[model samples]
Target: MDIKDKLAVDVLVVGSGIAGLKVSIELAKEGKSVLMSTKTQLCSGSSFYPLKASLGTQVTKNDEDKDLFLQDIEDVSHNMHDKDMAKIYIEEIKDRVDEFEEIGIQPYKLSDNRKACFANHGRTIYMLRDWNKIRENVTGILENYSNVTVMERSVVISLIKRNDKIIGAFLLDKNKELILIQCKAVVLASGGFGNIYKHNLNPNDVDGSGHILALEAGASLLNLEFIQFIPGFTTPKYKTLFGEHTLNYCEDFVDDSGNSILDEILPEGLSKEECLEVRSTHGPFTNSLVSKYFDIAMMKQIMKTRSEEGFELIYNKALYENESDFYTIYLNWLTERGINLLTDQVKIAPFAHASNGGVQVDHFGKTNVAGLYAVGELAGGIEGANRLGGNSTGACMVFGKRAAKDCLAYINENSFIEIDSQEELNKLNESMKHFSVHVDHSLTPNEVIDSIRDIMWFNGNVIRDEQNLLSAIEKIEELRKSFNISQFVDNVKDRKSAFKARNFIMLSKILLQAMLERKESRGAHYREDYPSEDERFNKRLFISLNDHELKLEFK
Candidate 1:
């Protein structure tokens, strides 16, 4: 096996998002040799991907409302969040926001009359600068850290564990060569699995590989059933997020056939105006509220038509003259992007936006595995059934810093294991041979991935039931059985695609199994067969792999 390179570091931070950046900075500040390997370039990930102009982090409105902020999170998520984790986030978020401002990524200067969206009360919204600008500011700060070495275009195929401790990781670089990095600790901050769905708003690199890597490394993932789906544009521009602020002004919600889509799915006695008003209050789809029919109706139309071209809406901006400061800024930003809601017939569909759950971690972002930690969207427990809008980014800051500081004790006590390049190369050789070995009539990796996306987007997204979940599981199993990595050892793109295909299969199966096991509707996870939340399943559910078999348990 051609092992491209071998190196050593005190810590290997996987990802380049807000969390990954924060972790690398903290470790570098402590003078620890840190290698930050990103699947893409710096400032690339969900955190820096501009989905909407009004996108920002949420914090407590005031110190007096700290308890209320926690209450809002609990109420919004249906009390499914980890109480301790939520508490940690609430206490630490203000400081993190301050750090952002100090680092030159300041919040937008909105008028005092600007109204908050998403949460009911005690939650203050800090409108962010353009995501591109935020990315520039963050990357600029990272440039000053001389102790950190960045390796881009690297995908972690797996971790190297000895006696159940993470000693290093195997990365496939852009050159299609395996690079091994021996480290005392591995921190996974690789965002979420939104891209696994055919329609999603996450960056292409957010493929849930971190979750799979942690799981295979003997870590548990929590609440895989809860994924947030929100509306995004389907025509003119693909995968652009559709903000809900304009929905209240949109009068005609129709499909290409000129049929009223929302009217078809709206419950009896519920006016379209009332539904739109409630739906505009939140961005993500939730079963706990009546506004859910908005997303359901959109998904129904797409599923019924089986076409990527979704439904359209006509907006009359003149209907509402006194727009909130938030709405005015959002509209202007949309105009800057060359989208005019009044002149444009906007087409939209429910797109997989974020995941509320991931690898289960403690308050310090330490997983069950001793030397492996998970932070950011890769780590679960901060948000539960549904995520509060801004907590996603907030958790990244809080846990990222915490993990970096906490892992020091472990690194101080432990020394590097005595594993050489040849020993690691032998293992890599066996893995490559298993995948590259010829098979009869094998499908391409992209083919398998496309099929996986279709199954996930249709059955596991927006709407779910017993039959469809089981069907998806069966189809996923068939894909797994048929997925023989073609002889493309020297092909870099194809090799990465092959690994991504494998990761998607593992992630899809876990998500489908979790959805089926939940057996009730809760927040973002709605099961039409059991249309109400069951208290028995109220606790967080966790999944782990043992002896290559998936096991799930509820806490």
Candidate 2:
């Protein structure tokens, strides 16, 4: 079970999502020995179930200009993105997409071979197929590469840095052994922190592991306050199951209690009044509320009335059955003729989905440190304040590849630094023994996790004020203190869950502290007290965490 005696590699890649897989495959193909690790199964991360396809570089008749693409990115990023680093990404888009196509990713194209416009310019592209298929195909290519070793159920506990240069990582192996992986380069492609909220569409393990690891390694984090909130799907029962992205585009809302609340709040362009008339006599639950926040208590009361009076107060039936995923199901409901809910307004509420700001990195995915690099959702300052829909997948793909390529290049140029495995092993042994003995079972890890999620969703989500953020920060700190008192079931599975929950609590504190420092509303970091976005506060915000204390500043 001891992993300290294991072999080393040229590059250590964390998280086997699309980003990690693609990058490792590329490096291995170039004859570099690469070791990739994932917290769970290879495809369990965010890339496997991405609701939409990305808009890559525009293929223009005029010379394929990277500057134009960079300009568009800066515009969407609200001028907060690093212009110099973004240039590298913009220039490589077409080549990257071509590489994917060569590997068998067929992107959907317009009839005239023109680009689609999700933003001001026609630059976005869609996949001709599904994401699961894409993930399978990519995984197959990675599997074929002999130089790459893929390790499943391995979690990266921390980065191994000496004198501010990252040389390797400390990984928790499947057998619960601390593995000291000595490598010339390391890449972090772990996905976002969507699971920080009580109700979110993200998977259970999306707890901001990469972000915390980077911060612990001395990487600079930017725009941690800008958490993206998507206005869609109602999870009346459970938070994780609602396909909010799908519901946002498909349904309409109706406040059937005869209150015209939907008419006042629904954004323009949607036919709100037409749906309102249909719901007045049909009952409240008869219509869908597309973007309006629901009162949880009110929804329960309405459901109760429907059950008692047989009034059919709320129904979530689709207007038409379609081939598309959950989002298309609701879209079909709105566009199709047979669905009654389409004629009625659907209720909608904003929930946290993505983090726009994260650890800042350069063109080669290097942080301020020499040997450390961050990829995927953990590497920030690229999306700026608000990330355009479908761009995250592309960002992960583009940056993941770049980080791996750069890491390999660095290894080829420099010699590997010597590391003492015994020293690392001794430290890990002491920590494990301490954790096993001192850890108490007074409160279950799941209970602590659930409480943190509830507090974050209530205070730090959607709209934030100074008072609420301060209260949330205090609660998160208290949870962190109590986490050590919780005891696992003394099994491998239970221990892993406990470790992940503890990491989540630490991450939640970072997010809460960042939210408290930002006073103005911009992109997804809306502040109720400040109310409006301020031009003077347009620069990016940065935070560094040391021993659980947050040092805040603007970049």
Candidate that would win on TM-score: 1
Query: What C-alpha lDDT do the candidate models reach, one value each?
Result: 0.82, 0.62
**Candidate 2 weakest lDDT stretch, 10 residues:** 279-288
**Clash number for model 1?**
0
Tens-digit lDDT track for model 1 on 1-555?
367888899999999887888887878878898998888887678877877765567776667878877777888777677899998888988778776653336775333422344576735666665667777776677678777888889888889988888899889887768888899999999999999998899989999999989998899998889998988888656787777877777787887778787877887999899988898888889998888888888777666777778788888867347476657767776777787777776898889978889988889999989899999998888787777777777777788889988998789889999676777767655654434435576667888899999999998889898999999999998887776764544565677888898788888999999999998999999998999999999788889998568999988
Cα lDDT tens digits for candidate 2, 189-241: 88788887875657766778888788877887887777765533342222222
RMSD of model 1, in Å? 2.2
Query: What clash count goes with each model?
Result: 0, 28
Q: By TM-score, how accurate is candidate 2?
A: 0.79
Question: Which stretches of model 2 miss by more than 4 angstroms?
Answer: 1-5, 52-72, 102-104, 112-118, 235-252, 255-258, 263-348, 426-441, 485-491
Assess candidate 1 and give its TM-score to the true structure. Answer: 0.95
